[model samples]
Target: MNEDLTFLVLRQLQANPKQTQLQLSQAIGISVGRTNYVVRALIERGLLKAEHFRNSKNKSAYAYLLTPEGIDTKARITARFIQRKRAEYDALRAELDQLTAEAEAEGLLPQ
Candidate 1:
């Protein structure tokens, strides 16, 4: 799975382990197949542990619990994501300020 999708799956799984693949697909805005594929990959990587829940309403239902490693990965991914967003926001803010100055210089914007 791609980095963006991997991060999202981890986040969604951490939020609710009981969420079905269909529910996760809808929440992540991806296809069920893709969601399954990603989850399988995570399981293979030892990040997520899928266990069947007999006491649950759905007999075939499973919970995707995060391992200790998975939690650490999530924290790292979250920090990186926040940093990337901050950089993007700073760049956009600077561009907007420049555009606003130009507009004001041209009298297109009220001073």
Candidate 2:
């Protein structure tokens, strides 16, 4: 359960609460089972709420939406994720610079 993917899933649900797990799986490129698992986890965590809606296509199915708590959680998690990734990118760039400097000093690569 990637936090990024989880946030994206929540965002998607926010956009279209009526979208089915099957549809979400297709959109997210994940399996239906994984989507179901994540959705159930979100419900258990009080991050999502589902309601049964009667549409022309399906009468007995439900759709999902983020709870107020879910929206807050999504924002927090997404911000943290972005910060972490940016830090990682910066660290990797620093490491690359060090390696390049070492290589140039050793005459292993062109300056």
Per-prediction TM-score: 0.91, 0.73
User: Which structure among the candidates has the greatest lDDT?
Assistant: 1
TM-score of 2: 0.73
lDDT agreement of model 2 with the native: 0.90
Candidate 1: C-alpha RMSD to true structure equals 1.3
For candidate 1, the lDDT comes to: 0.93
> Which residue pairs show collisions in model 1?
none
Off by over 4 Å in 2: 96-111
User: RMSD per prediction, one decimal?
Assistant: 1.3, 2.8
Lowest lDDT sum, 10 consecutive residues, model 2, at 54-63
Local distance difference test scores for all models: 0.93, 0.90
Over the stretch 1-111, how does candidate 2's per-residue lDDT look in tens digits?
Answer: 788888879988989888999999898889999999999999999999988886646775788979999999999988998999999999999999999999999999997
Residue-by-residue lDDT tens digits, candidate 1, 1-111: 676788899999999999999999999999999899999999999899999997887777999999999999889988888898899999999999999999999999999
